[model samples]
Each structure stands twice: as C-alpha cells, then as structure tokens.
Target: MTKEAWDGTVTKKSRGLLDGSSMYRRLELRLTDGSTVKVRVSRDLWDAVSEGDQVTKAAGEDPVKQ
Candidate 1:
C-alpha cells in the first residue's frame, strides 16, 4: 500500500484497542487537498512519517518514463 503523511484533524474517535494489545491507536488523516482525498492512516504510519522530513511515494518514478 502507498504511504504518505498529511495534515488532517480527527473528526471523530471512539475508544478501542487492536488485537487486545495495549498499543492505543486511532484512524487519522492528512488530506492532500480539500477535494476529500484525505489520506487514511494510522498512528503507527504517522510515527514513521514523523521520523522523516517529507512523505514520499513511488520514489524516483514517473509513469511517463515507462
């Protein structure tokens, strides 16, 4: 799956745990545009992105180059 970090707010959230693990998480988003393309992501994914400067997708690739 493609991974990209975005800037979005949690519109809503409910208390829950995944696989009975103590690791708490939530469904967050960082939209690339106001066109409703909110990038669905998890807290784990956010951490990975936070460890970097910018999110990257399909690195060094261009469809037109194909």
Candidate 2:
C-alpha cells in the first residue's frame, strides 16, 4: 500500500461504531495544503489530541501531535 503523509490542525474528534460492531475513532483535519479530511486513528492517538491541535503523520507512520 502507498503511504501518505500530512500535517494539519485538527478541526474535530469523534467516535462511532462501524456496522454496529466495530468501534472507531476519527479526526477531522484542515491540512496545510488547505484541504480537509477525516482520518481514522488509534485509541491512544485519539486521546492524545484535541481540536485545534497541530498534528503530523509521516509516510508509513502514525500521526503525532506537533
């Protein structure tokens, strides 16, 4: 799989069930490139960040708070 990297300010945080069975965490980001996207993240990473926090993900790596 191709790995992608991005840096952005988080706009929102949320959690929900997928198919009423699997739980998931998500972050909505406003990227440095001026686009917005939502990405699924681990529970630890989800708890580590908040709205408006800056975060970065390197290619093939998990996102980290900046």
Candidate 3:
C-alpha cells in the first residue's frame, strides 16, 4: 500500500488560483535518494506545510510516476 507521510524537506513551492475562489499550492520534493517528485496539495494542507515539508509514498505501494 502507498504510504502516507510527510518527510518535511521541501525544495520548491508554487501558488496559483485553483478554481474561482480556492487557491492551490504545488510542492516539489527532493528526496535523499536523489529523486524528484511533485505533489499538489489542497489549501487545507497549506497550513500543515512549511519551508521543509514533503509528501511521500511507498515504493511498491505507490503508483509508478508518469
């Protein structure tokens, strides 16, 4: 199963208008294994995020990156 955890190591973040009233935050993760992954979190998650936050998934559990 895909793991649901935050590694807390954010490298990049972006803000944009998601819909008409809501906003979106895109997070970029630079893993310790020298891999890059991107995740788009809801505004609710914004409060939980900081300068060094990341979202992670398990190796066999997570779907392959496209």
Q: What local lDDT score does residue 35 receive in model 1, on the 0 to 100 scale?
A: 27
lDDT of 2 by residue, 1-66 (tens): 129999999999999998799989999999999999999988998999989999999999888898
- Which is the leading candidate under TM-score? 2
What's model 1's TM-score?
Answer: 0.31
Of candidates 3 and 1, the better by lDDT:
3
Model 3 TM-score is: 0.52
The residue pairs found clashing in candidate 1 are 6-30
What is candidate 2's CA lDDT for residue 28?
98
Against the reference, the lDDT scores of all candidates come to 0.36, 0.92, 0.60
Global Cα RMSD, each model: 8.8, 1.3, 6.5
Q: Which candidate number maximizes lDDT?
A: 2
Backbone clash tally for model 2?
0
Model 3: runs farther than 4 Å from truth? 1-8, 18-22, 58-66
Off by over 4 Å in 2: none
**TM-score for each prediction?**
0.31, 0.91, 0.52
Model 3 lDDT per residue over 1-66, tens place:
435543435677788877868777777777767777777766665556666654554554432221
Write candidate 1's Cα lDDT for 10-63 as tens digits. 333333566697655333333346422323345555444432123323433311
